[model samples]
Target: MASIKQREDGVWRARYRDEVGKEHARHFALRRDAQRWLDEVAAAVVTGQYVDPKAGRITWDEWTREWMERQSWAMGTHEAAAVAVQSVPWREGQISSVKSSHVQAWVAGESKRGLAASTIKTRLNYIQMSFRAAVADRVIATNPALGVKAPRSRRAEAAMRILTAEEVREALDAADEFRGFVEVCVFAGLRLGEAAGLQLRDVNFLGRSITVARQVQGSTIKAARIVAPKYESERTVYVPDELMTSLAAHVTRAQVTAPDEQLFVTPLGRLWNRNNAAGEWRRVRKDARLPDEVTLHTLRHTFASNLIAQGCDVVTVQRALGHSTPSITLNVYSHLWPSAEDKTRSATASFMGEIRDSADSVRTETEKPQVRGSRYR
Candidate 1:
């Protein structure tokens, strides 16, 4: 049975019971609309397909945070995910009221705010994932975010900046004062934090290698901390001869006060932070007259690029850089692989030469003078 009410303003409200015995209500300016809604609800209830309107009232923002809190993400990954989730426009709102248009608007607004294409796409992905979880929980009948296209992240191709050999040399020369950190990053491909957190025990001078086991982090000098290396994988990278010489010299000059002390420390004997290293790299790059875009990570890219250009295989480079997979190394440095056109041309030329030689042999046999004198006559 359905109940109807008419307010003094003449608007009508209708209430009905669904097949599942759940109550639903709707208001309309016209009695016909209210009656129509009741009919639709009754038919849906008969078909066992009625959905409560209250389910669609949750806001997108509320569900996203709930999803994030319940997820177990990596150390830095959780922070990144939180930022992306917060970047959504309706981040604080209920998930049920969010429509596809809101997502599109958020993406467009993020672009207008000068967010990088990659960042915008990442935020969109996080939102979509959140909505997916909502869909699974029956908070919404369907994910409104489905089929939404994210802007392609062009910054990846645009930001493929690599340092020139001259710039690398200039930066290395300028880093003579902080040779240990510079050599490890530029040659051994140690990330900034890994290099700063390295202890003397992590170095094997006899093996000509260093183990990346931990990372230095935190904001305050009093609260400086060491965290496990990214991905929890400790890798040993072989040192180049030149880098070995620089490391040995820097160690002797620094006269490290404690064997357990960090190999790269500030003048105050505290762990070196990324900001300080970046500032030093910038100063060196400027002193060497290199472009301002060159950064500490640029040294790592240079190392990988130089290695790939030297015919080092992708797997070897992957291990050298402490990458978890060779695919990562190949994806970044595959462009530097030798061109296949030259090999194809050489192969074609070799095949053509063989064909020509075979043709000459056939012609020589066909044109040979008759040797009938020794035949029985």
Candidate 2:
């Protein structure tokens, strides 16, 4: 229900009862202005787009706090989300008022602050998600950040490195005490943290399978917490007999008999964290004389690339890498699928060749040897 009335004070008042019967009102200088406001409100209600005027009054800071509490995030994702939301430029203002211009300005500000393009893009994604949720909750009519563009991250793409067969061997030999750790990453495609969280129980030596159940979620030994794999990508990766034998030898060498004991650990038997793992990786890279651009994660890329080289399909590569979806696998490693264009040409040539062969075989005898052949003569 809605109404527009002129009071004795010469003010035009517009009033409406919302879907829940809560009343809202505003006073305007002109009767036409009050009527126009009522019409807009009625349209919004009929279109199922009605948002209570006061609902958007909550600030971005307050909304994000409530939103974060309701999300079920892994430890690492929660930390990243915390950092991302806190980094937004206008936390104190009403979230509904944030416009696309504000989001663009924030992107520009992040660039000026010397943040990496990828980092700025990630932060922008979080801001977009927040506004999208706000729109869904009826706290805002639209997502202001939906159309905002983020700066492109070119450096990371340019630096992607895939190793060859010999390079993989050299890197493994140079890994020294970390050989088994590097092997699992290169052969099984485990992320650094996933390999760190690997336990004896997760390995099926006879079956040559390793189950990815959890990951170490922090950089420091003291702060490290075991959590489910990223994006719930818990899965089993099958290994070659050679790699399985290597893991068996590693167990014997490390004397890790207990099923719960971590297969890969520091000399102090502590779980490997990124910081410590990076230091060792540097030594391995330098000793192996590999390109400086090759990081530990590159080994996982190499594994994926090798799978593509072996003619594995997208789902096979995605499952091997524990990617949440085949689209993500393609997004990251589509270049490695060498058969896309090749298969097109080959398929066309194969069918055309069959047509040509059929025509040649069925040709009339008159078209065959006109020269002196015994049968033709």
Candidate 3:
């Protein structure tokens, strides 16, 4: 309940207790203004929308630091999210002061600055997540980022460069000592970190399967740390005989017989990280004379392409490539799947061809009906 009265200063004062029994008051020059404020607070409380006026004064940086501390994200994920949080234009402003217009303006500015749409979208996602948490915590009345839209991603429309068998062979030959790493990526669809994190125990020779449970984090060996696979995509991936044989040969050649030893390491017996392997990757790419757009990741695309060509469904491809969802797999490789229209057209053409081929063997009922009435025809 709220009450209004004339204060000692001859001003109208409206006072009320919130749902939690916290007293609040506002003074206004006019009695109507005081009454209106009381009514608004009453309505907000009834609708379960009451927020402590002071709770939202925390700045974006302050709230984000608190929120991040509560998250159980991986080290790489935590670092990336921190970067996104730092990129917020309103990091120094109070969280409640942000409006939808401000978010839209920031997005527009990012686009004008020529940031990749994907990067902007990722950052926007992190912002939205934080804002949502704020709303749930009653630190803000609503999420300003709820309806904001990110710029369209151009990378989605770009053509993927899938390598051919001959190209794979040439790349393997050119990779020299790094052939095993490239082979795992191409055949098993492991990402760079996942491939580098492999240990002898991860391989099951009898089953010909490689278990992808963890990955090496950081860009260099000195800073590397083992972490769970991205999106918790830990599963066993079956490999072909050739890949299995290659792994065996690699193990024997490297003398890494210890089950806990890394499957792939530099010649110096240190772990292989992307930074240390980049120079050799460049040399191989050049020596193989591959397209400029073809990168180490292209081999992963090639693996998915082969699966789709072999009639693997979206779910199968998703699991094989360790994508978090089937939709993600389709988003990147939908164009590679044979369209229903193409299948229909091929079926109709094959049926027509069969009809034409058997046309001479067909006879109408009237052509053979002349002797049908005879008892012994």
Give the winner by TM-score. 3
Tens-place lDDT per residue, model 2, 1-377, is: 88888899999999999889899999999999999999999899889888998999999999998988898877777777778889877889988788899889989999999887888888888888888889899999888888888887775346568888899889988988899999999999999999999999999999999999989988788888788888858999999999999999999999999998899999887889988998899999999999887899999988887888888999998988888889998888877776568989988999999999888878865477666658855
Candidate 3 structure lDDT:
0.88
Please write out the lDDT profile of model 3 over residues 1-377, one tens digit for every residue.
68999989899988988778888888899999998998887787778787888889999999999999999988877877888889878999999999999999999998999887888999899989999999989999889999999998765437578999999999999987799999999999988889989999999988999999888887777778778889848988999988999889988988988888999888887877767766667889999998777878889999999999998999999999998899999989998988899999999999999997677457453356564476776
* Error in Å for residue 46 of model 1: 12
Off by over 4 Å in 2: 5-9, 111-121, 153-159, 165-170, 286-292, 344-377
- Against the hidden reference, what TM-scores do the models get? 0.75, 0.80, 0.85
Model 3 TM-score is: 0.85
Q: Rank the candidates by TM-score, best first.
A: 3, 2, 1
Clash count (model 2, backbone only):
0
Task: Please identify model 1 stretches exceeding 4 Å from their true place.
Answer: 1-23, 28-62, 155-158, 217-224, 257-259, 345-377
Candidate 2: clashing pairs of residues: none
lDDT of 2: 0.88
Clashing residue pair totals per candidate (backbone < 3 A): 9, 0, 0
**Candidates 1 and 2 compared by lDDT, better number:** 2
Summarize candidate 1's per-residue lDDT along 41-109 as a digit string, tens digits: 777657645557777576656666678889877545666677887876675566777789988888888
